[model samples]
Each structure stands twice: as structure tokens, then as C-alpha cells.
Target: MPFPHDRPTRGSDCDCLPRPSDTKGSDAKASDPKPSDPSPSDPALPVYVLRYQDAWFGMEKRVTFAAADLDAALAITEREPIGAWAELSQDGVLLCRRGGEPGGAADYWVVD
Candidate 1:
């Protein structure tokens, strides 16, 4: 069947897929509309520290802090006594060990 614009159908001997040369006079995608999503560059996201427990039934330590990103979260953790006390997370996503390690987690965090 032919396309709405009368373009050739694929696999029927002729295909109307846009070619490099056909893009010279106009840009179809550039003229189309699209819904933009929030990017890392957007300020909608913010780093947060999620406070949880290392062990469910132990008083060894109280809470944990996971940085939303590698920003102030990790930096603030440097001065904190992590390791077995609390773990780190970013953007509500837990990172590193669950029970906590050196407390100095990685920058493995992302934003929408």
C-alpha cells in the first residue's frame, strides 16, 4: 500500500524512506513538535539524604544518608562517620553496600 503522501511502501519494490539528499531542502523532524523532558541541566531535581537503618534489630547505629547526587551529599558524608553506621544513596536510589562500607559512596546517581 502507498503511504498517505503517496510515497512508495517498503518491501514492495520501492521504499520512500527519507534519503540524505532529500533532507537538503527541508528538515522534517526539526519542523515537528515534541514534548521535552526534564534533563539533568534542569533544576527540578535536588539531592537528598535518605536516612535508614544498617541492621533492623541492632542499636549499633541509627540512620543512613544517601546523597541524591555526588554533590553535597558525598562531600557532607566525608565529614560523617559512615561505615556500618549508615549507607549512601542518590535520587532516592540506594548506592554502594546496603549495610554500609566506607560511607564514602560513588557518584553513581542520576536525575530525570
Candidate 2:
């Protein structure tokens, strides 16, 4: 008895995998669309700053703040005591309006 053998078929109907370069152009365009300018409704976005005990001293600690809106929040943070950080959250309840170290000095307090 002889063993059965199968031959491979080649045609458009065949299910061969595509080569890497086959979809390069179209895929590149779709994947690399030009970035757009910032939108008004973008999130507050988080940022941080370190306050050192002194100019030569290493970072003493970090301060945190949150802006309900991005531009206003950034502006508010910019005008603060020294170093301030900001983060955007749908729920920033843990964050109080007050500015200070998480467990240290009290800088500014947020008023409801």
C-alpha cells in the first residue's frame, strides 16, 4: 500500500498570508494620521513639581492640585506658593482645594 500525498494549490482563491510590505502604504497612512491641535475640552492633564527644603537640598516633597478645566487649572497652578502639581480626574474628591503637602504645611484651601 502507498501513502496518500496532498499538493498545495496557489491562486487568488487561496488563503495565503499577506507579506509584511503588502499593506505598508495604506496601513502607514491609516496608522500615522497627522496629530491635531489641542481641543478646548481636553482633560485637566496631570503635572507635578517638587519643592526642595533649599536650593541645594534634594526634593523635600511634592504638591498636588487638580483643575476642573485644563487652561484654568494650569493657570491656577502656575500662580501658587512654589511648586505645585495637577492631575485630572472625573472624581478628585480626595483632593481638597487647599494647597499644601499631603501631610505637611497648609498653603491654600479650596472653598466649596
Candidate 3:
């Protein structure tokens, strides 16, 4: 199916309008169908962005990842390490790391 942008839309529903078969832009014969994309669809994993500094460039580098969560992102970074000081962002939102193992929530702050 042709995208709305590739072919003019029909109406408010935004359906692709079919091209005339008898003409080429109403001039000559029509051509073959548009070729479909061969690339795979987007990953289902949760999106993550790792923020780190580059040692060579001495500038910050942002690396995006599609994984289960921050833990999964960290695992990939461990294999192909980015930088010593790095932070993780999930779905484009930056997240803070938990200081310790799971215990009581008393040490943390809360709002009403």
C-alpha cells in the first residue's frame, strides 16, 4: 500500500488514492507497484539512552538502546563499555540509579 505522502489522500480518513491505470499522470501507460521496505520493524524492547563522555573527543556521547530496562542496557554497556561515568535513560526519560539493594523505603523522600 502506498503511504499518504507517496500518493494523494482520498478524504478526511487519509486513505491513499489509486492512480489511473490507463495513463501515466494521465499522459501514457502506468508502471509497476511501489517497492516495499525490506528493513525489519522497530524493536519491541523498552527504549533506553545511555549518556557518557568520550575519552578521545572529551565530549559527551549519547548512545540509544532498545532493551528490557536499565539493567539490560547496563549489561550491553558492560560488554562494549562506553565510559566510566554514564547514566541511563528509559524511553527518552533519564532515570536515577538505586543506591542500594531492595530494603525499606524509609530512607527515600516522598510527596503527598
Candidate 4:
């Protein structure tokens, strides 16, 4: 549906409003359905990408995984091949593997 800003306001002659031929309450339930609660199969667990620079030689790498906690995700990423120099973000900032090189800034999506 187009945004309200993109459409013209309804006037007295506008036929978009409810008509006598339309079934009111029958379609009302379908129009505004209640949202279901989050479940394990609902894909509620948050997903994030772990990004860091290589320790020995500077190289950027990212790993994506689903985890409940950020710490747990970091722990899982640490077990991977790049675990040695893999730096986890402390305050959701860039994870620095070496002293000088900083990870590029990019907004991560939080899966609902």
C-alpha cells in the first residue's frame, strides 16, 4: 500500500469508503488480525554477524550466526578458524584485532 503522504485525501464523493454491499464485521476480523506470540520456531532468536581483523596479517572477515546472547555468539565465532585474532565488540562497536586497524562501521540487522 502507498503511504498516506502519497495519496490524495478522501472527499465527500469518494467511493473508497464502506458501501452497503460490503460485509462489515466479516472482513473486519481479517483486516486486523492479532499478532501471534514469538516461539522457538518463529525465528525470534536474534542473528548477528561477527566481524574482525586478522591478527598476524590484517584481513577483514565476517561470520553470521543465530544466538540468544552476544557473548555466546562471540564464543561460537572464537572456535572457528579465525578465532585466534577474532575480536568481539565490547559496546556494539568495531572489534579491533590489532592495535591500529579498526573494523569498518556498518549497521547490523536484528532479526525479529
Candidate 5:
């Protein structure tokens, strides 16, 4: 007996994928949707500075980044594998702090 090499039957009539003619224009490419860099002073994401004391040497250290709020900033700090205690600041003003004990506390409180 001979084996059949015919193509498989169509599964459905619906076309889920978009066709090239449905695109915005002929000049449009898949990679053309790159977003512009956000400005440093973007209001949606305020800049924050995290200060902490090195657990091993007790030397002060700092890190800066943009976050949605103090909670987000603290979340980012918690992810870092650094000093046990850290202070989150914005515009040189202290907002909150975390881990201020010898054994390294797990909770952080607002400065106010």
C-alpha cells in the first residue's frame, strides 16, 4: 500500500491573525513602536533616593531611582540584597525607613 502525502484539511474558516494589508501603512514595521525615553522629572514616576548602612562595614550607601510612590520605593529596596536598614527619600527629604535593629527588622514605617 502507498502512503498518502496530501495536506491536512482546514480546521476553521476564521482568520485570527492580521494580514499585511491591514497594517497602518507600507512604511510601518513591527519594530517601529519603540517608546520614547521618559524625562527625569516625569510626574507619574517621582525620583527617590535610598540610603542605607552597609551591614558588614557600617559605611553609608545610597541608590537612586524613580518609583510610583513610597510603597513602590520600599518594594524595590526590599528586593535589593544590601544593608539591613534603609531610608527612602525624595528631593532630599526622608519619607520612610526600614530595619533599624541589630537582627534586621522586616518592617518599614513612614517617617511622618
Candidate 6:
């Protein structure tokens, strides 16, 4: 099915609304219809940005990866260095920050 962006705008002769033929009917058998929720295998999963900054050296690195939610992002942060600071952002907006201080929150802060 064509997304809104892919469709023709108003006043187009073809209308360009998604054609009913593009979708399966109720009686039709679906292909991969039951995709697992929040799984890495799902191509529609949301992508998040993880930025790491060294406390002393001020070195910075950014990683973009797919995650289902904040908890998944926290799980990925477990592999980061203990003393380094990390920030999780989505769509260029800061979601939370963690690390860089002794006995900080085990997970992250400022966002659920």
C-alpha cells in the first residue's frame, strides 16, 4: 500500500488514494502477518541514537540502532564503559542521560 507521502496530492486525476486492491481481503491469507512485537527481527522497529562521551578524555561516539523502547536502550547501555557518560535520543531529541557520575541511576533519567 502506498503511504500518504507516496500518494498523489489533491486535484490529481487519479486521486491516488491507496487502491483497495493493494490490501488483502479478510478471506485472503496474509504473508508474515504476525510479526513479533518489539523484536529486532521486525523491520518497522524504531531506531534510536546512543551517544557516549568519555568522562576524562572528552572523546565522543554516536551509535544508531533499532530498539523497541527505553528498556531495550538501557539494556544496550550495559556494555558501555562504567565511567563513561551516555545519552539516548530519538529523532534528534534527547530522551535521557546516564553515567558520568558515581552511583548514578542504574538505568537512565528524565524520560520513561
TM-scores of all predicted structures: 0.29, 0.23, 0.41, 0.34, 0.54, 0.49
Candidates sorted by lDDT, best first? 5, 6, 4, 3, 1, 2
Provide the lowest-lDDT 10-residue window in model 6: 103-112
Question: How would you order the candidates by TM-score, starting with the best?
Answer: 5, 6, 3, 4, 1, 2
Clashing pairs in 4: none
Candidate 6, residue 106: the lDDT equals: 58
> What digit string (tens of lDDT, one per residue) describes model 6 on residues 51-74?
888545678978788887778877
Candidate 5 residue spans exceeding 4 A from truth: 1-43, 82-84, 102-107
Top TM-score model: 5
Model 1 lDDT per residue over 85-112, tens place? 4555555666543343355554232332
Candidate 2 lDDT at 90 equals: 30
lDDT tens readout by residue for model 4, 19-54: 555565465555564566433334666665667665
Candidate 4 segments whose C-alpha is farther than 4 A from its true place: 1-42, 55-57, 82-112
Task: Give per-residue CA lDDT, model 3, range 1-112, as digits (tens).
Answer: 8566765454345535544442455643345433442212246567776676554665777777676655666676554334335666676566743122256332221111
Q: lDDT score of model 1?
A: 0.49
User: Clash pairs of candidate 6?
Assistant: none
Where does candidate 2 have its weakest 10-residue lDDT segment?
Answer: 50-59
**Which prediction has more favorable lDDT, 2 or 4?**
4
Best by lDDT: 5
| Candidate 5 per-residue C-alpha lDDT over 4-111 given as tens digits, one digit per residue, 9 for 90 to 100 | 324332443334555555575776576664455554566778899988887678888888889877777777887664566778889988887766555655555558
